[model samples]
Target: MDSPICLIENLNGTLSVNEQAIDYLMGLEQKIVVVAIVGLYRTGKSYLMNKLARSKTGFALGGTIQSKTKGIWMWRVDHPAKADRAIILLDTEGLGDVEKGDSKSDAWIFALSILLSSTLIYNSRGTIDNDAVEKLQPNRYVTELTELIKVKASSGASSADDEEGSGSQFVQFFPNFVWVVRDFTLQLELNGKDIDADQYLENSLKLKKGFGKNISDYNMTRDCIRNFFPTRKCFVFPFPATVEKMQLLDTLEDKQLSKKFSSTADTFCRFIYENSPVKTILGGKTLTGRMLGHLINTYVATINSGNVPCLENAILAMAELENQAALEDAFVMYKKEMEVVKALFPVDSSHLSENHLKSQTRSTHAFMERSLKDTDGKYSAILAGKIKEYANNLFEENQDASEKKCKALLDKLSATMDHGVKEGTYSTPGGYELYCDHHDTLMARYRAEPNKGVKAEEVLEQFLKEKSAESSSILQADIKLTENEKHIQAEKNKTSQMAQEKAALDERH
Candidate 1:
C-alpha cells in the first residue's frame, strides 16, 4: 500500500468526532463511581484531586480559599486519546469544624453518604487529633455506621449479598506519621517519656498507650467500630505537613527515598482494587462507558476523514519532508510511556489537546528540517558569512561565535534520541542534540573510518528505525481505534431505540 498517510489528519478526524461521542457515552451513566478526598482544610485534598485529573481546577479551589469553611465539590474525568479510563473525583468539606452552626450532624450525613456510595480517600495529613480525624470518631461517624449496620443486620439486610455490596475493607495502620514542624521543632512526648527527636518508630503498643489511650483512640476505635461492623475494615495513614523540612520532602524523588512513599501509595491502591463495590466501580468492565467515549471520538474523526490510508500517507510525506519524523516518533513513544510518566508525577489528560498535538507536530517538523539544512544546506556559504558578521557585532573577541553557532546546531542534531522521555515532562526542545550527541559522535565516526565512512542512507536507516520503534509503542492506541468502530456499529444497531427514547424524553421536557 502506497506508504499509508500520516497520523496527523487521522488524529484530527478522530478528535473532532470523539468529542460528541464522549457526551453520549457519559450521558448513559451505566457505570459511575464517585471517589471522595476528605481531610482537614488546606491538607491538600483539592491538590491531590487536581493531581489525579491533571488539571488546575483543584488548584483554583485552593486559590479560592479565603478562610476555613465547608463546601463540597465534584469533578468528572474523561479518557485520554490513548487510554480507556474514566474517573469521577469528589471533594468533601473539611470535617471537624464548619464556620457556622452545628455541622456535626451534617458532616456525619455527608460522610455516611460517601461511605455508602463511594471509595473513601481520606487525607494522609489528617491524624489522631487532626480535626478531620476527630470527626470520624466511633461516637460520631463510625457510631452512625455501627448503628446502620445494626439496623441492617436486624432488618435482615446483613446477608452475604449485602456484605459484598457494602464494599468496605479492614484496617491497616501506617507506621510513621510526619508532623509538619515548619522551620521549628517542638518536643513530642511519647508514653509519658520525653522521646529524643530525630526520627522514631513507635510499636503498636506504644501507639495504643500514647495516641490510642481510650476507645476514642484509633486502634481501640476499631474495636467499637467492629462491634457494629464485624465485616467492615478501616485504615490509617499519618502524614506530617511540617513547614520546616517541607522543601526537602517535597523535592525528594521516589528513588531517593527507597520507595517509602511509593510503597504507601501501592497499599492504598491495593485496598481500593480489592474492595467489593469499589472493585466493580474501577473495574475495566464498568469503565466501558468511558472507554467507548474514546472509541467514539476516534471513530467520528475517522468517518470525517474518510480514507485512513490516504490521510496517513499525506501527513507522513509532509512530516518527513519537513523533518518531523522524530516528532511523529515522539508522540508514539508518549503512548507507551504514559504509565511511567504518571508514576513519577501523576497527570491528567486534560492538558493534552488536539490543537496542542498538532502544534507540537508542526514545530518538531520545522525544527528537524532546520537542523539538517543549517548543517549542510545550499546557503551554507552565505549563512556562514552572515553569521561571521553577526558574531563580530557582539564584541571584538567574538569572531569565533559565528562558527560556533553553526557547529552547535550540527552538534544538537547529532545528539537527538539518546535519552527516553523524562518523567513528569510533557515536551522536549526539538533538534539533533535532542536526538543524540551529534557533533562529537559524527566527528568520531568520520575519524574512525575516514576512507570507509558513513553515508546518507545509513543515517536515514537509523532515523527510520527510531521512528518505527516509536510507532510500535502502545497497542492501546491501536485497540482504541478498533473499539471506536465497535461503538459505531453498536450505535447503528440501537439507533431506532435511541431515537424513540430521545423523543419521549424531549416530549416530557
Candidate 2:
C-alpha cells in the first residue's frame, strides 16, 4: 500500500505545475481528468511513474508518504498535447509484509481505503501465488476489500468479477478479481516431497492432511479470488540487462506506460462519472426536453451557421442581442453546480483525480466552450433571428422610393421569368416564397388545361377561396386574379363587411 502512496507522492510532485495550469484553463471552461497508478511496492511503481513524468513535464513536488497517512495520494501529471488537460495518477502500496508492524497495519488500512475508493489493481509480477496471497487467514482487510470489489463490479464499472466465497461468512462482498499479471515469467517453488505442481487433486489431498481447517479456508479464499478474477489483464514487458540496464535507467525516466494505463484509467474515471449519485439528480434537473430540442434547433439552424468573424465576434453579436453575459454566466454556474453535484454523489467506483476527467475526453471542454458562446443556449432561435435581421437590413437598404417605381421593376422582372417558377428567380423574400411558388404553379397548371375531368374554373375558384380564408390580412394576400370570379367576389364582400363593422365600432367609441 505504501508503494501506491509513494507513487502518488512522486506523481503529485511531477504534476503540481500542470495541475495549476489546468485549474486555470478549467476556470476558462476547460476539463481535466486524472487517473490513479497503483501496484505493490518495488514493483517498478516509482520507476514507471518517473518515466511517465518525464514524458510529460517535470516531476510533481509532493514528498514521500509519512507513516501517519495511509493509502495512496493523488497528483496531476502534465499532458504534452494540451496543458489545460492532464492525467493525475495515484500510487498505492504493496500488500502482505510481516517485518514492518506499523507499516503492515498502514498497508491494510490503505488497501481497504483503495478498495473503497478505486477500481482495484491486482498488480502482480508473474505468478499469483507470491508472498502476498500466501498469508490468507480471516482478516478485516480481505473482508473490506472483497466487499468493495462487489460494489464496483455490480455497478458495471468493472470488467471482471469473482464469486469464490460461497458459504463463507464474508462471501457476499468479494467481487470478481482480475489477474494483472505483467511481464509473464513463471517461477515454481519445490517442497522436497512427492508432490506434483500440475496435479491439483494431489496438492489438495496433501494440503488437507498437512494444513487442516486453516488450509481449507485459505483454499476457499484462494479459489474464490482465482475464479472471480480469472481473466487476464496481462502484458509483456522487456526486462533490461545488468550494466546496460544501469545506464538505461536514465531512459527509464523518460518511458511511460500510457498504452498500458489508458484503458484502465478510462474505465476507472468513467466509473466515477457514471455511478456518482449526484449525476442522477443533475440529469433529472435539466431543462425540459421540448425546450432543449428548440434550443438545439436554434443553435444548429442559426448561430452555428451564421456569419461571424470568430468566437469573439460571436460573443459580440450575442452581447448586442442582449443575452451574451447571461450565456457566459450560465456556463459558469453550471460548472459550479456540477462540482457540488460531484460532492454529493459518493463515487464508490474508481478514485480518479480531477485532471483525468478533462484529459481523457476533449469533448467535455468543447461542450463547455460551445455552451459559453450560446446566447441563452437557444441556438436555433439565435441563428434564425440573425438571418431575419440581415434580410430586413438588405430589404430596407434596397427599397424603392415609391409604389409605382417598385411595381414597374417588379413587372419587368416578372416578364423576364416564366409566370410559374423557371429554373431560378427571386419572387418573395425569405422562404415565404413557398406561397408565391404555390400560386404560380397553380396558375400555370390552370392555363395548360391538359386534363378535362375537373373544371378549371371550379378548381381555380376553390384554390382562391381557400387561400383567401387562410390569409390573415388582405394586403398580404393575393387579392386579384380575373375580374369576375366567385372566390374574388366572396373576398370583396368579406372585406366590405369587415370595413363596415370597424366603422360602426369606431363610431360607438
Candidate 3:
C-alpha cells in the first residue's frame, strides 16, 4: 500500500475490523512476516514502523501528547531479505491514553498485536529501569495478555489456575519479543562491565531473590516478559535530536537526524528483515496473507463478542476455511488438465489411464501445498473422491465415443454389401461362395482401419454375430454345395465366430 490503512478500528471502546484492509490482505499470495509495535501514548512507535516500511512517512507520527494512531494501522511491503515473502508492519494506537479511559480496550489491542505479529516490539522511552518495567504491568500491557487471550477454547482448570498456567503456553504461541527503548541515555554496564543490548535486557529482567508481596510484584512483569516470550531482543536508541527538532522528526531527512540514531535505526531494520520468522500457527503451518486475513477477523470478532481470543479456536476456524478452499483448488486443477485429454476422445485405454494418473498426482500436490491442519485427512479424502469420480466420468465418455466411431465405420464399410443383399444377388448356384468372399474382404478392410479405440474388437464381434444367421441361410440355399462341403463351411463359420469373441474379450480385459 502507498500508505498504511486501519486494519482494526477502535471506536468508543469497541473494536471492529476494517473490511477494506482485510480485502487488500486477502489478495496477497506471499507468506508474511508481521511486526507489531505497541507502547504508551507518544512513544515513537509509528516512526519505527515507517522506517521498516522503507518510507519516510507512512504511519502517522504525531508531535503532540495525544495518541494519534487509534486501533491498529497496517502497512504491507515486500520482504527485503526473503524471496516470495512480505513484511506486514502494524502500528497500534498508543497505550495508556488518559482521554480513552479504557484499560480493557488497550489490553485487547495488546493481545491482538501479540496474536497477529511474528515479532512484537514493546516500544518504551528513557530506560529499562524498575519504573519503566512496572509500566508494562497491571493497567499497562503484558500482564493483561493472559486475561485477554486464552490458549485453548475450553479448559478444565479454574479461571484462577488457568491464568497462572497459561503463561507457559503463551511462550509457544507468542511472537519474538523486542524491547525498543527510545531516548535511552543510560550506559550499558552491569557490575562495572560493559554489556551488549541483549545482556542488558536480560539483566533488567532478572528476578530478585525474595518472596514477599513487594518482591513478588517487583518480579511479576519481568517474569511474565521472560516466560511468555522466551526469544527476546533489545534495541536502545539515543535521542534523535533536540526537543525542538524532535517534534519534526517525521519530516527530517536521514542526514538531518543524529548519526548514531540513524545508524542504529538502519541496523534495526536489517535485523527485523533478516531475523523475523514467517508467521505460523500450531503444527508449524505457515500462514499466507489470506490466512492472516482470516485470523484477523476471527480474533477481533471473538474479542468484540466479550470472549477471550483462543489460539486453538482461531487455528481451527482458519483450517476449515483453508481446507475447503484447498479441496476446490485441487479439483479445479484436475479438471482443467483432464479437459485437455478429454478433447482427444476415443483414446486408447492405456493412454487415458496414464493421463489420469498424472493429473491426479498434480492435483494432490496442489492440495497439499495450501491445506493445513488436515490431521484426519478429511479434505484429502474428499479431493481423492472427487478426482476419482471425474476420472470415471471421463472413461465412460471415452468408451461411448469409441462405440459411436466404430459403429459408424462399420456401417460405411458394409454399404455396398447391404445394397447387394437387398438386390438378391446371392441367390445364384455359386453366389454363396461370392458372398463369403465379399464378407471376408469387408472384415479385412475394417480390421485395417486405425484409431478405432478400445471398443474396436467388441463392436466388430457384435456385427459378425448379427450377420451369422444370414450367412447360414445363404449357405443352405446354394444348389452347387454338396452335403460334406456344406458341413465343412458350417464348421469354419463356427470357428471364426469363436475366435472373434475371444479377441474381443481379450481386448476388454
lDDT of 2 by residue, 1-509 (tens): 11212222212112111233223323332233333334444344434444444333232322233222123444444444555444334444443333233333433333332322222344445444424454332243443344322222123222224332231322222222222434434433346444322332223223233467876655554564443333213232334223335333434432343343444434433443332211000112222212222222222223224321121232234333334333344334434543542443322122222422342233234334434334365743443454345434423322322223333333444443334334433222331345555557546644554322213344445545755643333223333322235677899999999999999999999
Q: Count the backbone clashes (under 3 Å) in each candidate.
A: 37, 44, 0
Model 2 error, position 211 (Å): 12
* Structural similarity to truth (TM-score) of each candidate: 0.32, 0.32, 0.88
User: Which clashing pairs does model 3 show?
Assistant: none
Candidate 1 residue-pair clash tally? 37
Compared with the true structure, all predictions reach lDDT values of: 0.38, 0.36, 0.89
When 2 and 3 are scored with TM-score, the better candidate is 3
Candidate 1 vs. true structure, TM-score: 0.32
Error of model 3, residue 54, in angstroms: 0.9
**Ranking of predictions according to lDDT:** 3, 1, 2
